[model samples]
Target: MAEQRMPLPPLLLDGAEYHADPIRRALSALAGDRAGRFAPGDLAAAMGSDYTMTVTPGRASVPAPADGTGGVYLVESAAPVTLAVTPPHATRDRIDRLVAYVVPAQAGGTPGAWYLAVREGEPAASPVPPAVGAALVLYDLWVHSAASGRPIELSDMRLSGGQQMLAGGTLAGAERPATAPAGTVWTSTTTRQSWAYSGTAWRLLGVQDDTLASHALSGSRAWGPGVNEQAVDNLTFGPGRNGGLIELSAGVVHLSRPGRWALSMQAFSDDGTPGSSKVWLDWPGGPWLTRDLCDTRMRGGGFAGAGVLHQPISWTGVVTSDQALNAITIRGAFTPSTGGNRPSYMVWLYVDYLGR
Candidate 1:
């Protein structure tokens, strides 16, 4: 359908003759058909044409409104608000979409209102051909980036077509189909799961679950009795095989997002009078807190088993911080009951990441 018009209101004011309702002229371009509205600039850039859009009492609005029979339809506003939209079917897609937004009204001017309309559906082909572009949204959620149009089909949530799907006879017997095609898949006799074919072979259309079950170890480092030190360990700890997120030198870790993080450590120390090892939280430029890990038991008898002692310690704590762009430093120190002995070495530091 084309743009349609509504009856114009009489140009009169409070008990006297006057100009048109300032609201009506502001939205003069809108009508029942060609219900679409746009600013002069958007139309020029997108379609190389000059156009203005207006609305009726049911369409004029202040805050942008959603399209439908419901919601607050724009009847009037305090200002003349402008809106812009790209022509529908600008790219090759099964359906076209119309989008609009309201611009803030001009300062120190008569307040105006506009029609709020958003649309998406299969419509008549456009008079103008699709524009050349790098990417275009095909269906509601489908996307294509190449200029060359190729069919990459998604079969029952599994993707196939020019790429990877295959068919190995998995059904009952000779009566069963031989190969799974591009867009259609068949159930397997073995696993009984649906499979689709690409250029290569048939692949499964299913979900998978991967668990983080293994323990990743960090290389050990030593600490003295009276001086502050970093319990250096292998920094190979992060998402999958990418490596860890924490720094071994500065002991700083730049977080991807803020959430709950748990750190657990099992350590061993050399012979000494034996004392507690302290672990501190360093948010770098933020707050600092310490956790005292107990010395547990002291065992010795070296120098042919004379003064040799070993103390086992465990440290665990939870940290909650803000999202990205924040950094953390974990600091540690060992306090010996007596001086002159290298009392500690961090053996293992296990980290667990959890969401809030």
Candidate 2:
């Protein structure tokens, strides 16, 4: 039995605005009596130009019939054209619903490429070509510079959605380094502060409360048969101020060096004798030199010399004497070097003694 061929539907080459007359005539000739009922091989042979048709999966390139209704159609134009097709409702397989063509190159003729995409079961107007929609959506796309890449110039680009352009790290807006300059010392701006550094430790500089206020020791003003018992008082000390007596009660005096020193006290005498007066000095933890007042005459009479005494003997061992009393007294001034480069010293006296 001979195979029966399906009848080709009519062809409606609608929207032929810019289609070449020769190409339309060629298509019409190929779709001769059954113009739309073209098989794959027949359609390929009919568009007799130098182009190729590649049918992807689920897609076919069949020919449209001549009649305008119930037949396939091809619309071609240059100034933007739309091709509309209405497939039968029963056409479920996408392969049976649409047709596309590629214009082939003729001898010595310039050939340009076009595009066609078909959606199944859509009405003639439903699948409008996306040129307008694509043009509208292109307004939303933008580009930005990455940290590792060169910065994008805003003047040469377009951006949407309030995007801001930032300069690159190599540009003037780069981040600054967070390091300090070498040899720059950090010191506090307070008078009561100190800066200290150890070779093996971190340097520290700050203000701390002076802790030698109520714990200092004083000395006797008068010499006596029972030892000079001095009632010393009225003292103030701090960092910049005098660091009062570091009371060493029979404590080990670490003598890193040795030199001439003196033991003196500011005092108030009540009975006008060296044995009957109140003296003020730091506590005695010294190998202090002694000053003899044997020939030193008393200024106010009655055996009491109301002044500081410079003891005139040098020693290095610790004096383990409990002869030091404490109200506000200091005992020794041991000069580590008698040659003038002495450690700085500051001393305070009782300018006003409000003893009750």
Candidate 3:
């Protein structure tokens, strides 16, 4: 007789063979028809053995079956089992089942407030909320003109507090230093003579003659309104009977005494003739004689004298026939010489008051 062989229990075959294959596979088979489920021992074995299983709740294991079919069955007197399986890659459709949900609060009761923070070895987090009542700051982004290739263009422009604004037509309050216009010209006149404020110090522009003789001439002589009076006198002497004699005297005699004088003369031969004798005298007399009178035969043999004199002479007391005398002579004589025979003689005698 063959030993009676009870039919192998289905659990004893493939489905019930818990110790035959990996614990995760047997438990996964037993969690029948659920989206995700897990057993404790299976979860620990999967994590410890492979380190690739995901043991998070509601992540990878299926739920327990309601009909007790194809689920992890705890046999009588057997420790409960846990099974772990690799979770599927996260998908938009399964995100709610796999991931936790977190809702963020609004900032200042307004939307659109957002920030980001990055950390090492971890996922980045959102930034903190901004202060209340704060204004939004913005940067100045310059935009150039496409046609002109410039940032700005205008006839007049202005700036205030780092911001530029356009001016309407005119600049009313703008203050600037005075400036000369283009092509501006200035003119003035200058003179060579010295000038004074009262117009009195300016001299004549051309040559000026200030001499007394030049002032006395009849031409257009410019004269200042000041007094211009001049006087001169002259007297002269020569060799006469008494060795030396006062030959000629001429001057501008004033009433009491003359102030201005000038005279000239020449003499030749011992005879006193009109053309043979010439004489002149000025105040402060002397033998102011020129030319050789010793050789009387030469046509030019005569004494010549010419000079200018300024002296004071008396002219009030007595008069004489000789015009050279200033006054009457108390004692004097005139001896006339014979032609080419005797020596000539000239006498000048007069007396007058020597006035101041």
Can you write out model 3's per-residue Cα lDDT over 226-325, one digit (the tens) per residue? 3121111232222222111122224222111222222212222232211222222233221223311121121222222211111112223222223323
Tell me how candidate 3 scores on lDDT.
0.22
Using lDDT as the measure, the top candidate is 1
Give lDDT tens digits, candidate 1, residues 125-193.
332222212111111212122242532221121111121122222344222255443434565343233
Write the residue-wise lDDT of candidate 2 on 1-356 in tens digits. 99966443234446433435345555444333122211112111111112122222221222232222222223332232233323233312111122333333442234433234332322232222222211101011111213223221111111122211211112111222232222122333432323232222213232244331222222232233333232223233323433222322232111111222223323322232221122223334433343212111222223334322332211223332232222123332212111222111122232111111
List the candidates ranked by TM-score, beginning with the highest: 1, 2, 3
Lowest lDDT sum, 10 consecutive residues, model 1, at 154-163
The most accurate candidate by TM-score is: 1
TM-score of 2: 0.18
Residue 296's lDDT within candidate 3 is 19
lDDT of 1 at 193: 38
**Model 2 regions lying over 4 Å from their true place:** 1-189, 197-233, 237-265, 270-328, 331-356
TM-score of 1: 0.31
Assess every candidate by TM-score: 0.31, 0.18, 0.11
